[model samples]
Target: MIVIINYGSGNLKSIKNGFTKIGEETVISQDIREMEKADALVLPGVGAFGTAMEHLESYKDIIHEHINNGKPFLGVCLGLQVLFTKSQENKGVKGLDIFKGEVMKIPEEGLKIPHMGWNNLKIVNECSILDGIENDYMYFVHSYYAKPDDEDIIAATTNYGIDLTAAVCRDNVFATQFHPEKSGEVGLNILKNFVKSIPSK
Candidate 1:
């Protein structure tokens, strides 16, 4: 089983459906006990950063424990942002600190606030989740992006106004700033790679 963490912020059904389309069983829930039985974990969210983190706080221990135990973990959108140290989305909002960085609003000088629609990725490093996805268009809907203290964790990037971190990974943790569920074939392939990468039970 693959557990999708539901903290009242993610696009739950879409994500679950995406996995099911690829023939992966996923349960959307907040039950830490259920999460522990999974071969992999996925955190997908769309909402205010502060509020999302508040909901996720109670489950952090199980989340961390699951990942520390070497289960594959993937986070999407707000899920990706919340893994950082902090965010400007809601002033003084602290993140899970799983990665060193802060989220910031996309520079608003020239481009649209929420960079909506298709964009191509610039692969930063080789990652199994991104296999065969280099230069392919992926859907994006966001206003803020994460700024990692160490650039080495960046797995891929997309150019909006500037080069934005599209995806990141370190050890068992992998995350994307875009919604693969909404991103079509390329996105599904990304998820496919993720599902395939999950350590065998």
Candidate 2:
């Protein structure tokens, strides 16, 4: 079973529908203990950084435990941002520090603030979650993106004036700045890949 965390700040229904469409079992709950029973956990979010971090404090330790133990983890949008050490937005609020990095706002020199549209991903490294998903368009809607301390952790990148981290994975922990749930077929395939890659319970 997969657990979609519901500490608030996510398009819960759309995320659930995405998994359900792929025929995967999932439960949306704020219960941290439910994570222990999950084959994999997904952190989906949309909104401000500090507020999200505040809500996540209650489950931060458990989330750290889950990812640290190498259980499969997938973060989306603000979900991806919170995996870093800190974010430039929201007065530089601290993140979960799951990976050594900081979130930076996408360069707005020649583009819009919230990169809201489909963008082609430039595959950086190989990972199971991105199998056969290279060069495909994924939906994005965010102002800030993660800049990991380790470039090797970046699974894929997309350009929004400057190359931005689009997807990241370190061991069993995986995250995407784009909403795979709203990216249509390719997006759903990405989620399917994650579900299929989980270690048997």
What would the TM-scores of all predictions be? Answer: 0.97, 0.97
Q: How high is the CA lDDT of each candidate model?
A: 0.90, 0.91
**Which window of 10 residues has the lowest lDDT sum in candidate 2?**
104-113
- Flag clash pairs in model 1: none
lDDT for 1 in candidate 2 is 85
Residue 156 C-alpha lDDT in model 2: 98
Candidate with top lDDT is 2
Off by over 4 Å in 1: none
Cα lDDT of model 2 overall? 0.91
**Which regions of candidate 2 are displaced past 4 Å?**
none
lDDT of 1 by residue, 1-201 (tens): 899998888569999989899888889988988988888989998889999988998888888888789889999999899999999998787798899999999998888879899899999987889988879888899999999999999999999879999999998889999889999988898899998878683
Backbone clash count, each prediction separately: 0, 0
Candidate 2 lDDT over 54-144, as tens digits, reads 9998989989888878889999999999999998897667899988988988887877789999999999999889998979999999999
